[model samples]
Target: MTNIWEPIRIGRMNLPHRFAMAPLTRSRAQADGTPGELAAEYYGQRASLGLLISEGTQPSADGQGYPNTPGIYTDDHVRGWQRVTSAVHARGGHLFIQLMHAGRMGHPDNTAHGRAPVAPSAIAPGEKMFTLGGLKDAPVPRPLATEEVPATIADYRHAAARSIEAGADGVEIHGANGYLIQQFFSPNANTRTDSYGGSIENRARFGLEVVAAVVDEVGADRTGIRLSPGSRLGGIAEGEGHEAFYLHLVKELARFDLAYLHVAHGGNEELLRRIRELWPKALLVNRVNRPLEAATADVEAGLADVAPVGRWALSNPDFIERFRRGAALNPPDPQTFYGSGAAGYTDYPHLEASAASA
Candidate 1:
C-alpha cells in the first residue's frame, strides 16, 4: 500500500508529500487582469501544501470570463505573478499556473475585449455569468474562422512562456471544466464541419495542438493538463461516444510524456481505470465532492499519485499540518469563496489559532 506521505516525483520537481492544493478561482485580481496585491499573501500562506496550482489564468483578453481573473499574456500580468511565485518558492513550494480560455463561457461585459465569446461553434451555453456590470445570460459566441485556430493555439504557447518567465515550476493547460478545450469535446458546443469537428480525433485536434504548442515552448517536463472525462459543468454533454472519446484522448495524451495528467474525476470508474492503465506518467486525481478520507484512500489503493484538494486547502492553509497532526479543519465559507477580500481568502484559522481561541 502506498502511503500518501511518501515522497513522489512528478515531472522535474520533487514533492515532499502527495496532498496538493487544487487550482481554484477566487475572483481577486486587479481590473487590468493582474493578480491582486493580496494574492501573494493568500498563496504564500498556503505554501505548506507543497504543490499549489494557481487559479485558472486567462491566456488573452478574450479568454477572460469572470471579473478580476488574472491573465498571463502581458508584462503587468507577468510582474504580478512574479510576486506570487516568489512567495511560494521562498517557502519551498512548487506552483503550476493553469492556463484557461473561457470560450463560450466568456461574457463581453466582464472583459475589455467587449465582444461576444468565441467557441468551436456559434452556440450559446445558456448559462448566466456575473460580471462587473451585472449578471447576464451567456451570449452566443462567434465561431472562429478556420485560419484563426492556429493563432488561438499560439496563445497557449505564449502564455506558457509567460508563466515560465514569471518563475512558475510548470503550466497546466485547463482542458477540463467546460472551458474552451472541453467546449471542443462536446457535440453541442462544437458543430464545426472543418478539421476541428465531425470526429473524435478532429475534435481532439485543437486541444492536442495547444498542448503540443505549450510543450514546444516550455519543455514537456514543465507542462501538464487537466481533464474531466464525464463532467457536465457549464451544461456540457459529452455525447454518446464519450467513453470511447476519452479513452482515445487519454491514449493520445500519454505520448507527450508530460509532467502529469490531472483528472477532475466524477465517478467514471471504468474510464478512470482505463486512463490509469494508459497514462504513463504522474496522475493527479481530484474527486469532486469527496472527503479527505476518500482522497487518501484512493492514493493508498494506488488509484492516484496525488490527491488535489480544493475547499479543504482553501479554508485551511495549514491543511497539511492539520492532516499530519490529525487535527480539525476550518469549514469553508461559501459566501467568501468567490469574493475579493481577506475575510475568507487568507483569514482562515489554522490549528494553532483554533487552539488559542479555545
Candidate 2:
C-alpha cells in the first residue's frame, strides 16, 4: 500500500491521507468582511481532501488589507464561517482557519474604518494593493508602540479562540506573504530599535508572540504556523545570511510541540530535508505549483508529512480521487475567481465517479 494513502495523526485528529488543501485567497466574501453565501458550497465541494485551510482572514479591522476578505473578530464573521465548517465536516473533512494580518500592505480604500495600516516599522511595502477605487500605492504604516504590541498579539489569540468556537479544528498563524508578522521578519520592513527588532531573535519576537498567544488560546497540539523563508513578495527582503534566521526560528518553534509547521517556498529536496530535521512535528509543505508528482515524491522521501495543494483544489471538486486515478482536472477561469456569484465558484464539474456526478 502507498504511504500517501495511509492514515496519520496530526494533533488529536487522525487523517485518512496525507493530501491537504492549502489556503488560497479568492476575495469572494461580502464587502463588509463577512463570509458570503457561496462559501459553504465552495468548500463543501472539495471536502474530499483530508484537510482544508481556509483563506487568510483578518483578526481585526486594521489587519485587513484586501477588499472582500473575511474577518474572525466580529460576531457576524464567526457565524458566517460556521456554515463553512459545518459543511466541510459533513463530508468528513478537517478545517483550519488561517489568521492573516496584512500590515503595511494595505490601502485606506480597502479597510472599512479607512485607517492607516500598522506594522513593525513605519515603512511602505513599495507596491500597491487593490482598493475600491482602484490599484494604489500602499501607505507607510504606523510603527507599533512597545506598549501596544501586546494588544496586537492578543488580537491573534482572540481570533484563534473564535475559530474553534466557529467549529474549526485548528488555526494557522499567517506569518508569511509580506503580512503583519512577515513584515517584522523582513529587515527591509522592520526598522525598530525595541526588543522586537535589530537581531534575528528580536525580529522574530512578534511572530513567536503571536504563535504563543494562539497556542495558549488553542492547545499547542491544535496550532500551526506558516512561513516563506525565501519569498520576497510585496517587496519584503530578508537580509543576507538569513538562512540562519529560519534555522533558529524553526528550532525554537519546535519546542512548542505544535501540530505542524507549514512552509511555503520550502519545496527543494535539500532545503526540505534540512528543515525537516529541525522541526519535530508534522511538516505541511506548500508553494505555488505543487504538482501531483512532486507531492508524491516528497511524501515518499519523508521530506514532507503532508503536501498541501491550493489552486488545483480551487478548480477541481474531486481533487483527491482525480489525483489518485491520474485523471484530468478542471481548469479554473481567472475572470470568475473573485466575482459575486456561483458562475465559477460552486458550479465547477466533478468526476462522474464523484457523488455529485458533476
Candidate 3:
C-alpha cells in the first residue's frame, strides 16, 4: 500500500512525502502586490510537506481580485518571491507558484490602478468581493476583444517565466474556483459567440491555450493546472454538461504531458474517476475540510497520487510530524485566516512548542 508519508517524484523534484499544501489566499501581501516580509518564514515553516503551493498570485495588474493579493508581473514581486523560494529550498521543499488570474471576480476598488476586470463576456458573477473600501458587489466585467486574447495568454507565459526566474520549481495555472479560466469554462458567465466561447471545445480553448503557452515558456514537466469540474463557486452555474465539459478538458490537457493535474474535488466521484483515467500522469486531489485520515485513504486507495490539504496545513506548521506521530492538531482560527500580520499566519505552534506549553 502506498503510504501518504512515502516519497514521490513530481516533475524534476523528489517530494519527501505525498501530502502537498493546497494554495490558500490569506490576503497578506503588501498594497503594491508584493509578498509581505514574513512570507518566507511562513512558507519555510511548512517546507517539510511534499509540496508548498503558494497562494493565488496574479499574472497582471488587472488580475487582482482581492486586496493585498500578490502578483508576479513586476520586479518587486520577483524579488519578494525570491526570498520565499530561497527559504523553502533551504529546507528541501519544492514550491509551485499558483498563477491565478481573477477575471470577473475582481472589483475595481481592489485593483491597484482601478482597472475594470476583463472576462470572456461582459457579465458580472453577481458575487460580492473584498475590497479596500469594504465588501462590494462585483461589477460587470469589460469583455476582452478578440484581439486582446493573445495578450492575456502572453501574461500567463510571462508570469510562468518570472516564477522560474524567482527560483520556483514550477507554476500551477489556476483554472478552478470561478477564476478567469473557470469563467471561460462556465456557460452562464461566458455567453460570447467568438472562437473562445459557446460549445464545450470552444470554452476549453482558452484554458488549453494558456496551458500550452505556459508549457512553452516553462517545460511541460514544470507545468501543472488546478481544476474544479463541478464547482459552483463565485455564483457560477454550469447547469448541465458539467462532467462532459471537464472530461473533454482533461483529455485535451493530457496531451501536453504536464507535471500534474490538481483537482479540487466537488463531490463527483464518477467524474473524478474519469479524469484520473484520462490523465496518465501525476494527480493531486484536494478534499476540502476533510480530516487527515480521509486524505491518507485517497493516497492509499490510488485515487490520488497525493492529497493536498489547506486549513490543516495552514494551522499546523508541523503537520507532517503531527500526522506521523498521531499527535493532536491546532484548530485553525477562521477570524485571522485572512489579514495582514503574524498573529494567525505564523503564530501557530508546532508539536514541541505545544508539548512544552502543556
Candidate 4:
C-alpha cells in the first residue's frame, strides 16, 4: 500500500518520499522584500522534508499583503533565494517557491507600495491585517482594469522566470487561501461584469491565464498550483453553487499538463474525491489541522500523491528522522512562528539534540 514513506514522482522531480513541507508564512524577510539572512539555514535544516515549499512570495510589489513577506520579482530577490535553493539542493532536497499575490486582504500600511490592494473587484476582506503601523482593517482593493489583468498575469510569468533563475527546482502559484487567484474565484470578492468575472469560466480565466503564463515561461514540469475549494478565508464566499465551479476550474487547469495540483482541503471529501478523479498527475493534499498520525491518510487511500505538513514539520526540522525513530516532537511556539529572529525559526531542536537532552 502507498504511504508517506514511499517515493513519489512529481513533475520532473523524483522525490525520495511523499513528505512535502507545506508553505508556512514566517514573515522574516527584509523590508526590501528580500529573504532573511537565516532563510537558507532555516530551509536547509528542514531539507529532510524531501520537498521544501517556501512561504508566500509575492510576484509583484502590489502583490504583497503583509510586512516582511518575501518577493520574487526583483534581481535582489532572485539573489536572496539562490542561497536558499543552493542550501536545499546541497542537502538533496528540492525547493518550490510559492508565488502568492494577496488581493483584497491587504493594508497599504502592510506593503511597502503604500497603494491600495488590487483585485478582480473593489471589495474588502473585512479582516484586520498586520501592518507596519500596527493592526488595521483591510481596505477595499482597487479593481484591476480589464486591460490591466493581462499585465497582472504577466507578473506571475516574470516571477516564475526569476524563480527558475534562482535555481529553484520549481514554482507553485498560490491560487488558494483567498489570495489573488482565489479572490477571482470567490463571488463575494469578485463581482465584476468584465470577462474576468461573473460566470465560472470568466472567473477562472484570470487563474488560467496566470498559470498558462507561468507554464510558458517555465516548463509545465516546473510549475504547480495550490487551490482551496470552498474556502471562506479573506471573507470570500464561493457561493452556494460552488462545487460545480471548483470542479470546472480543476478540469480546466489539468489541460496545462503542469506539475502537481496542491489542495488546501476545506472539509469537502466528496469534492476532493472528484478532484482526484479529474487530475491525471500528482495531487498534494494538506488535511488542514489534522494530527500527525493522519497526515498521510489521504495518501494511503490513494487520494493524495503527497502528504504536506505545516506545524509538525516546522517544529521538527528532522521531521522524517524523528518519525522513523518515533521521537517526541518539540512543541511549536506560537510567538516565534512569525518573527524576525531565529528563536523558534531555526532554534527548533533536531532529533539528535532532543535525544541528547533526554
Candidate 5:
C-alpha cells in the first residue's frame, strides 16, 4: 500500500512525501503586489510538505483579482519571491508558483492600475468581489481584441520565466477557481465568436496556448496546471458538455507531458476517473475538507498520485508530523484565513509546542 508519507517523483523533482500544500490566498502581500516580509516564514513553516504551491500570483498588473495578492511580473515582485523560494529550498522543499490571471474577477479598486478587467468577452460574472471599500459588484470586463490575446499568453510565459529565475522548482498555471483560464472554459463567461471561442476546442485554446507558451519558456517537467471541472464559482456556468470539454482539454494537455495535473475535485467521479486515465503524468487530487484517511485512501487506491490539502495545511504547518503521530490538530479560524498578519498564518502550534504546553 502506498502511504501518503511515501516519496514520489513528479517530473524531475522527487518529492519527499505525497501530500502537497495546495495554494491558499492569504492576502499577505504588499499593496504593490510584492510579497510581504513574512511571506518567506509563512511558506517555509510548511516546507515539510512534499510540494508547496504558492497562492494565486498575478501574471501581470491587470491580472490581480483581490487586494494584496502577489505578482511575478515586476522586478520587485521577483525580488520579493526570491526570499520565499530561498527559505523553502533551504528546508529541502519544492515550491511551484501558481501563475493566475484574474480576468473578469477583478475589481477596479482591487487592482493597482484601476484598469478595466479583460476577458474573452465583455460579459460580467455578475459576482461581487472584495475591495478596500467592502464587497462590490464586479464590473463588466473589456473584451480582448484578437491581436491582444497573444500578449496575454506572453504574460504567462514571462511569469513562468520569472518564477524559475526566482528559484522556484516550477510553475502551476492557475486554470481553476473561475479565474482567467476557467473564464475561457465557461461558455457563459466566454461568448466570443473568434477562433478562441465557440466550440470546445476553441474555448480550450487560450488555456492550451498559455500552457504551451509556459512550456516553451520552461520545460514541461517544470510546468503544471490546476483545473476545476464543472465549477460554478464567480458566476460561471459551463452549461452542457462540461465533462466532455474537460476530457478533451486534459487529453490535449497530456501531449505536453507536464509535471502533474492538480484537479480540484468538484463531485464528478466519472470526470475524475477519465482524467486519471487520460493524464500520463502525476495526478494531485484536492478533496476539500476530506479527512486524512480519505486522502490516504485516494492515493492507496490509485485514484490520485498525491493529495493536496488546504485548511489543514494552513492551520498545521507540521501537518505531516501530526498525521504521522495522530496528533490533535489546531482548528483554523475562518476569519483569519485571509488577512495581513501572523496570527492565523504562522501562529498555529506544532505537536512539540502542544505537547510542551500540556
Candidate 6:
C-alpha cells in the first residue's frame, strides 16, 4: 500500500490515512470574528482527508489579525465551531482548530476595538498586514508586561478548553509563521530582558509555558503544535540561529510527549532528524508548495509519519482519491483564497462530479 494511504496513530486518534489537510487561512468568518454559518459545510466537504486542521483561530479578541478570521474564546464562537466539528465527525474526519495569537502581526484596524497588538517585547514586525482597509503598516505593539504573561498563557488554556467543548478532536498551537509564539522565539521581535527573552531557553519560555498550560487543560494526547524552525515571514528574522533555538526548544518540548509535532517546510535535515530523535511519537510534516513527487518521496523515506497538503486539499475535495488514482489536481485560485463566501471555499467539486462532467 502507498504510505500516504496507510493508517497512522497520532496520539489517541487512529487516523485512517497519513493524508491531512494542512491549516490554510480563509478569512470567511463573521464581522465579530466568529466562524461563518457555512463553516460546517466547508469542512464537511473535505472530510475525506483523515485529519483537518482548521485555519488559524484567535484565542482572544486582541489576538485577531486578519479581517473575518475565527476566534475560539467567546460563547458564540464555541457554538459556531461546534457545528463545524459535528459536520466533520459525521463525515468521518478528525478536526483540530489551530489556535493562533497574532501578536505584532496584527493591525489595530483589524483587531476588535482597535486595540494595539501586544508581544513579548515592544518591537513591531516592521511590515504591513491586510486590514479592513488596504494594506497598512503594523503599529508598534506594546511589550506584554512580565506580570501579564500569565494571563496570555491562561488565554491559550481557556481556548483549548473551549475547543474540546466545541467537540474538536484536538488543538494545534500555532507556533509558526511569525505569529505570537514565534514572535517570542525570534530575537528581532522579542528583545525583553525578562524570562521570555535573551537566551534561546528564555526566548522559547513563553511558547513552552503556553503549551504546558494548554496541555494541563487539555491532555497532552490531544494537544498538537506547529513550528517553523527557520521561517522569516511577517518581518521576523531569527537572529539567534534557527538550529540552536529550535533544537533546544524541541528537546525541551519532547519531554511533554504531546499528540504530535507539525513542522513547516523550512526546517533543515539535521534539525528535523534531531526533532525525530527527541520526539519519539507522531510527526506531521507539510511540504508547502512542493511538487507531488517530492512530497511522496519524503513520505516514502519516512521523514514524517504524515504529510499534509494545503492548497491541494482546498481545491480538490477528494484530494486523497485523486492522488491515489494519480489523477489531475485542481489548481486553487489565489484570488478567492481569502474571500468572504463559498465562491472558492466549499464549491470545489469532488472526483465523482468531475467524472460525471467528463
For 314-338, candidate 4 gives per-residue lDDT tens digits of: 8999989988777778889998888
lDDT values, one for every candidate: 0.92, 0.87, 0.92, 0.91, 0.92, 0.89
Per-residue accuracy of model 6 over 106-181 as CA lDDT, tens digit each? 8888866988989888877888889878999988998899999999999999999999999999999999999999
| Model 5, backbone clash pairs (residues 3+ apart or across chains), number | 0
TM-score of 1: 0.99
Give me the runs in candidate 3 sitting further than 4 Å from their true place. none
Error of 1 at 283 (Å): 0.4
Window of ten residues with lowest summed lDDT in model 3: 288-297
Model 2, position 185: C-alpha lDDT score: 91
Candidate 3: tens digits of C-alpha lDDT, residues 1-358: 8987788898998988889999999999999989998899999999998699999999999788998899998999999999999999999898999999999999988876988999989989998988878889999999999899999999999999999999999999999999999999999999989999999999999999999999999999999999998788987888778998998999899999999999999888999888888999999999877866676888898889999989999999989999889999999999998875998899999999999999
The count of backbone overlaps in candidate 6 is: 0
For the record, the alpha-carbon RMSD of candidate 3 to the native fold, in angstroms, is 0.8
Of 1 and 6, the candidate ahead on lDDT is 1
Tell me the deviation in Å of residue 314 in model 5. 0.5
Residue 335's lDDT within candidate 4 is 88
Candidate with better TM-score, 1 vs 6: 1
The window of 10 residues in a row where model 6 has the poorest summed lDDT is 293-302
lDDT (0-100) at residue 124 of candidate 3?
Answer: 90
Per-residue lDDT of 67 in model 4: 87
lDDT of 5 by residue, 1-358 (tens): 7877788999778998889999999998999989998999989999999699999999999899999899999999999999999999999888999999999998999986898999989999999999889999999999999999999999999999999999999999999989999999899999889999999999999999999999999999999999999888888889778999999999999999999999998888888999989989999999866876686878988989998989999999999889888878889999998874988998999899989999
What is the per-residue lDDT of model 2 for residues 153-256, given as tens digits with 9 covering 90 to 100? 99999999999999999999999988999888989998899999989999989999888899889999889999988778878988665688888889889988
